[model samples]
Target: MSGSAVRSLVSALLLMVLLAAAGCAGGKKEPETLTVFAAASLTESFGTLGKAFEKSHPGVTVKFNFGGSSTLAQQIVQGAPADVFAAASPATMKQSGAPSPRIFARNRLEIAVPKGNPAHVAALKDLANPAVKVALCAEQVPCGAAAVKALAAGGVTVKPVTQEQDVKAALSKVRLGEVDAALVYRTDVKAAAGAVEGIEFPEADKAINDYPIAAVPKTAHLVLAREFIDLVLSDQGRRVLTDAGFTAV
Candidate 1:
């Protein structure tokens, strides 16, 4: 072969090798994303935890679906492709068939009102006032169930103007001034910070919601799911939960 032609052939082979290496690199899969379905009340705290997990794991991404515990659990049961499930109540977790869930924290119901408590609402019985427009979680959600227990324990009967699907929804009603008050988790009230105020009632002790977390069975990201759960159960996790107004379990 001519010397110039030999040099051109070598250059072409080098280009092909570089192209093949680039193609292989492009074909490599990215890091896996772990999907977590959690209760609506966990929104703020879980969001913080997810970010912390991602920071600790470097290459992994944490995705969250926060909503009513029952709604989330039902979605998971209906095959929503979640790797981890965090429920506000064990009943919902059991209903979803999540195996061996560990209770990580507990929360209690409180009266959530607009920052100023404009309606002058005080105790659980105040919710029964004819002039007060109250919101409550729907009967199906964990927060709703806890509200019912607390109301009964206090011998207070209130007819809410609106029944929300989740604690956040009920809290939204109060935040938006759509209602005088709504019963929601203490953590939720804390999450709202200055937007809303939480009122403690003696009856709240009667109904405490336990937050349970577990790795979904048969998930492709089982190891990551378990690791996330461990992160939640760790001392750091407890601190986060406590800071969010949850009682560590």
Candidate 2:
């Protein structure tokens, strides 16, 4: 080929390469990250969902902080950098001013006893017996409120050996056999996956706990947060929650 023609061909190839490189490096997209604050009761479900969310959204990371709903709400109020908050109760969601939340699932209180029913806690009234050594959640928690309502519905008055701050703590007492029996959400008991045995009482229906989820106001990953929230309310999310023993809300 002639020298001039060869030079022109080289220039054209270089220009095309530059344009392709520019397209590949467009804007240096920032990594997407989402931080979720969920209730202790949602530990298992959210853990599963977090993994799924991350897998579905490449270049995105989903971080979860599972704890008492009240504690999570307080953290968000204290300026914690949470993108999403899922509370086991509506009262905890009330603390977030970001946006209105929607109910995602519901759970009911159940009597969790050690395997083999060592405490002989056959019914709700049996929990009132002084010898049963019941473990209960503190009044500030949703499970505790359900416990109180279930007790009142059954006309049972009893003092618990211990009051836990969260449902898992209460369930741990039962699993460790530290307490004879404790009241925890049925979904929690289910998530425990046989670590503890659950007993359903007639009054449990009166004390069902509702779970609500919302995006935080100052989320750095608002788009992803909203997407995660949408996923939780999706049919697939509902199926997962139901499989974990939560009722549709």
Candidate 3:
């Protein structure tokens, strides 16, 4: 064909391609996002549950905000835009002002020491020794509250070198060798992937923490929130939680 004919054909093809691309873009629907505010200890289990939820429900995305339950509750109470809230304790869920919270699992504190147990830490009372550097969660958080009760039950007093805002933060101190040990949830120690080892004590039984989950009352995605909570309370969810060292409630 002549040069002008060839140029005209190329221009027509380009226009057709642009129209097709625009049509595709216009036809696509944005995936709906379900925002879950969960305690830091639920990171691995909830992550797996979120993936399963997404796989089962097409065109939906699961987003998570993991932190101290108390902090997450405060964020939700301040209207940070959350669909669901799963707290390490019912108190935190109540603090979030999210109604109809349900207990799904339970957890207990354990002494997390470095893999080698360099400080020769073995029991809750060992934390009281001035020679042992211990990390702990802040008193406002569930893990910290449980720690206090457990320590009390054991008649032990500890002076922590650093108090973190969450269980994961406290556990990190032990994993990083920043402290000789940390009082964290059993699940947290299990999630450490061998970076730290857990030492169970009788006092932990006296301070078991109940985990609660709820659909945020002000959530725009209430349906998704409830469904996620349902998944968390389901048999499959129990298996996941149990494998992660949480006790099924």
Candidate 4:
């Protein structure tokens, strides 16, 4: 009785090992790795959506390189090997040669001031005060272009001590109290929460910035790239972005 039981146990163990090896060889191809270069402004929302995408496509690892839109675009053009690039503004996407980039969302400029708006910059025109240190995005980026347009519409010229490379950087000046105010997107001020308060300017609408997303043309993982881009335009993605203060496009 003892010999038979031992033989049966050994045979079962051998079979189990063989099955495990087979599973390893045949299991759904390991999740593909998709790298994304996204604008810093999308940090919170994309972080949420990336998790959802990973859940839906089990085994797929989503890695993000969040930075200034123009910077990210330059990296892509210089061959950063990202699967996808999502910019805070369409003008940035153009820098990466992302032809036909889809406008997935839109944002409008707002005046971001120190918490409680100590300066009480009630209107856009107030930004021109010589006493106030204003921060602005460089005109090369979409937000900066929008800021210029908005100022022109208001018939005032802004003199920011520094022209930041991105909206977040410009906003950072205000957040750090280095500047009295900054022209950034409403979504950014919202994301900052208590750090900054957003003041809506009537001229913002005429210069709204469109956020665009595109599958990087140099992507080696085009399948996964397209998949992630589709996810960005999907209903679930829209919900996340909208909740983050973006207007879905």
TM-score of each: 0.88, 0.90, 0.88, 0.87
Q: Write the per-residue lDDT of candidate 1 for residues 1-249, one digit (tens) a residue.
A: 999999999999999999999998988557889999999999998999999999988779999999998888888878889999999999999877879999999999999999889999999999999899999999889999999999999899999999998888999999999999999999989889789998999999999998899988778899899999999999999999999999997
TM-score of 4: 0.87
Instruction: Specify the poorest-scoring 10-residue window by lDDT in model 3.
Output: 22-31
Taking the tens digit of each residue's C-alpha lDDT, what string does model 3 give over 1-249?
A: 999999999999999999999999988667899999999999999999999999988899999999999999999888898999999998899999998889999999989999999999988889999999999999999999999999999999999999999999999889889999999999989899899999999999999999999999879988889899999999999999999999998
Instruction: Report the candidate with higher lDDT, 2 versus 4.
Output: 2
Error (Å) of candidate 2 at residue 109 is: 0.8
**Per-residue lDDT of model 2, residues 1-249, tens digit only:** 999999999999999999999998985566777999998988888888888898898888888888888878888999999999999889879976658899999999889999889868889999989888999999888889889989999999979999988999999998898999999998888988888899999999888888999999888778899899998999889888998898975
The C-alpha RMSD of each candidate to the native structure, in angstroms, is 3.8, 3.0, 6.1, 4.3
lDDT, each prediction: 0.92, 0.89, 0.94, 0.87
TM-score of 2: 0.90
- Point out where model 1 deviates above 4 Å: 1-29
Query: Top TM-score: which candidate number?
Result: 2
| Candidate 3, number of clashes | 0
**How would you encode candidate 4's per-residue C-alpha lDDT over 1-249 as one tens digit per residue?**
699999999999999999999999998886578898988778888899899889988898899998778888888888887888998777788889976688888888899999877787999999889988899988877678889999999998888899988777888999899998999888889899778988998999789878889888867888888888888899988888899999996
C-alpha-based local distance difference test score of model 4: 0.87
Model 2 clash pairs? none
